[model samples]
Target: MKSEHTETPVTVLGLGRMGSALAGALLAAGHPTTVWNRTPGKADALVARGALRADTVADAVTASDLLVVCVLDHAAVTALLQPVAGQLAGRTLVNLTSGSPEQARETAAWAAGHGIAYLDGGIMTTPEGVGLPTSMILYSGSPEALAAHRGTLAVLGDPIDLGADAGLASLYDAGLLGLMWSVFGGWLHATALVGADGVAAGTFTPVALRWLTTVGGFLDRYAGQIDAGHYPGDDATIDVQLAAVEHLLHAGRERGVDGRLPEFHRELMAKAVAEGNGGDSYARLVDAFRRP
Candidate 1:
């Protein structure tokens, strides 16, 4: 039976791991995909998978009205697209390249000058996670462009629209990566502490995951406190958390485990208490992170 949805033609301008995954997802969704890579041989597997291989960037850009570029960096994106700028007018360009928010805004401006529709994107998953609906792909800029191609883009992942700011996708991407690393550091530290008592990481991780789910609830509550700039200590005060952190520090020291992670928390909590905010909610420590 023929599907009711029509496939949107897609052009992928890079064949790196992430780019190849993007093209592969589109092709799997039955979209006509044209792909090009700086190193031609990189497109071999994709070509074999029914993607049309483009001999040049220009050919790739002109192959479809919906163009996606995922290259090394912002410089590479600019270098590759500048020559094809004239051909991109009236077409939508979705850049999945990792870059700074400033670079995203700059690219958006460049696209606007050339009459090209632009969407800056941040792929929240690794190459292997590309086609999973659970994976999130954040996008900003050109709301119209996003609405127009959202169905095609959904094949890569769940599309999260951040509106027309253009720089928000990269900004949020950077913040999320920082959060991920912080979570990793805390998890590894906890795993080591438990392992010292002969607990296997495998055994401890499930418990840790449940604890994280509880922590997520705390975050949801704290987010409201943060936005309102009023953190009540009804649930848990900074003073209470500060005292609890000492146990973690002492436990780490006794186990010969690194104390740096807990030490940072201790420092933050201690400072908040010293400043007479001890009775405030732990979310009050957000002040510690603000620019002085």
Candidate 2:
């Protein structure tokens, strides 16, 4: 039988940077937390802050109806919890480990097989962002389980219920990271280009930040068009964009700036155009990713 929560006591597994932040947030929110880390010494700070240090994984999971696991990966989480599967029969397992969508779905199935209600999560914020309303944590899994611990989960961050599809959180996490890398890649290239003219990154930081903020609105507008498969060149066509990219490539080469970054953009734009999308919006290039 599953254990019933009478006082909202919570269990935290893994005491890494993110895990410690989560446990600290819970303690600050006045929830009695039971903590267990593979390395016994890692729980010292939480122990000093009134969290009960569990001697074993079983004991930790047994201590609370809501068990939060934030390990390194799916394999580590599986190994750590395999020994305590029996104890998790009725417990709600919220996994905040970063992994692929397939891993999340497989773990969800394993949890269901053990009669555990599972929720997969992706923390979009850093450790310092925990407990703040702005800290967005995407979650997907059993609705009932989420509803049961919504209050407790909110103590860590904003609990966004994506859906019953356990893989959604991880999918969103991967997609967000791809977007982040794209932005970062552009920034690094821009900084390098300006640095060639003896301009420090600090001097160009505000300009880059302002431009990124303004361009962010394109994501929302393009999302609709991308989903609908409508590649209308309402704002800018791929051909026009490709022309601009060519000028960038030429300028980077002339200025002796590393042309690798701009070359990549030029190649992508050229490929999209060659694929008969020259008249379409730049957003239409996203389809190329699905070609495989």
- Per candidate, the number of residue pairs that clash is 0, 0
Expressed as tens digits, the lDDT of each residue in 196-238 for candidate 2 is 8889999999999999877888878898999999989888998
Model 1 earns a TM-score of 0.98
Candidate 1 clash pair list: none
lDDT winner: 1
Residue 50 accuracy (lDDT) in model 1: 88
lDDT of each: 0.95, 0.91
TM, every model = 0.98, 0.94
What residue runs in model 1 are displaced by over 4 Å at the alpha carbon?
A: 1-5
Model 1 poorest ten-residue lDDT run: 1-10
